[model samples]
Target: MKNSKLLIIAAFFSIYFIWGSTYLFNKIAVTEIPPLFLGGIRFFTAGVLIMLIARFMKISLKLSKSQFINSVIAAFLFLVYGNGVFVWALKYVDSGFAALLASTQPLFVLFLLRLIDGQKMQRKSVIGVLLGVFGMYLLVSQKEISTSEGSVLGIFMILSCVLSWSYGSVFVSKADLPKNYLVSTGYQMLIAGFLLGVSSLIFKETWISPLSWSNKAQVSVTVLIIFGSIVAFTAFNYLLKVVSPEKVATSAYVNPVIALLLGWYLLDEQLTEQSVIASIILLTGVYFITSRKRIAKIKVTTKSQKI
Candidate 1:
């Protein structure tokens, strides 16, 4: 029991801090490596590592044909376009700003649910949507920030990626995914890694050899693969089984904050007053949406258990 409690705490820390730190690490590695190529190598290596771990744990590596297809689709949506392109955009945008922008995933997910499932929004959720929109406006409309050379394009691309990810989240909920989340994630990463490699080749990206990379880039990519992909992701899956989804979801709130701080401190990215206020509003909106979802989920669980 004591060890389980310690493990839970450690898992939460991994998802919150390690996952959060990935934004900064990705920015560093992407500086020296082409984004698609970097993502390809990172995810492929991570996928292999995860599969080994799964096998050691006696987890099944098998999946149905439909599960394989769905995993591929999910991989394309979540990693290839969603993550690879977002990292590509980091060349033009500050890591902190990108993190803030990416934090709007829940808002996009809420809207996507409405459109796809014909789900009605609750009052708090509606308020959250409004706040999220306003916060996004404040985030992007900063004259000094948006007018920079390619920042506008980067922001737009990142937003599109977020939409793709949000849609993937919804799709995965209803899709025939592998029963084991770790197995599912490993398959998605492996499939996405291959597709990203193809994309890199199609784009004719200059793939930097490990020997050619700077020490910083090498360290950054290593951290991204080992800590970011494997450790944090495994921690996330573990949390979903042991904790409330809402509690696990709180990592969303902390991730951007950690990114913002790390970017500002380590990368010397700009941290304007307006950005601070925008983050507050955006996270608040996310809190509203997630908290409501938590309540609804709890009620349903309680009712089902009673029956």
Candidate 2:
């Protein structure tokens, strides 16, 4: 039990730090790498590595036909479109700004899940979602107001990315995934990688290029594969085994904080007062929306047991 608790804490920090740093890495990578190619290489290599590791562990790789199809659908929605747009958006926006927008995903998830599951939306959850949306507006539009112009298309693309990811998350939760998390993730990554690679060929001209051995690009790609893909994912899987989903999901709130700090310190990105205020409001809103439901459920269960 103690070890499980320790693992959960480690997983939380890993997800928080690794995912936060990915925004910076993506920003640097897109400077020289094409967006689709960057995503393709990242996912493809990570998938291959994960598969090899699974094989070494003697894990079965076979999947039911339905599972395969579902994995592909989830991958297409989450990775191909979701991560694809993220990399593309990073080309236009600051990494900090992009992450801020992406962080609104929990709001989208809550709204969509309520609709699909036919779950009643609590008043607190609705207010939280509204506050979060307002916070997002403040963060994005503030920069536009100051600069007198902004990339409205870029904002839309990032929000689309968020929506795609939110849908994917809900779908994954509902889908009957393989019991082995590593195997499931490996298949999803492979499917997503293949689709992204094909999209790169069709939509992007520079799918493959002469390899450059620059230190910055090399470091960024290496960190993304090792820390972002492998370690963070493994940690997340472990976390789910040891902790409740609610606790693990708190990484949604923590990741943005890490992203903002890393962006400010390492990338020299400026955080306006509005951005700070928005972050707080958004996190608070998420807390209310996600936690209130759990709290209510617990109370009801306790009262029923007493009866």
The lDDT leader among the candidates is: 1
| Model 1 global lDDT (CA atoms, 0 to 1) | 0.77
Ten-residue segment with the worst summed lDDT in candidate 2?
298-307
Error of 2 at 217 (Å): 1.1
Worst 10 residues of 1 by lDDT: 298-307
TM-score of each: 0.83, 0.83
lDDT of 1 by residue, 174-293 (tens): 566688878987988898889999999999999878999999998999999999888887676566556543345456556776787787788676778987897788678766765664
- lDDT of model 2 at position 263: 73
For candidate 2, the lDDT comes to 0.72
Residue 130 displacement (Å), model 1 = 3.2
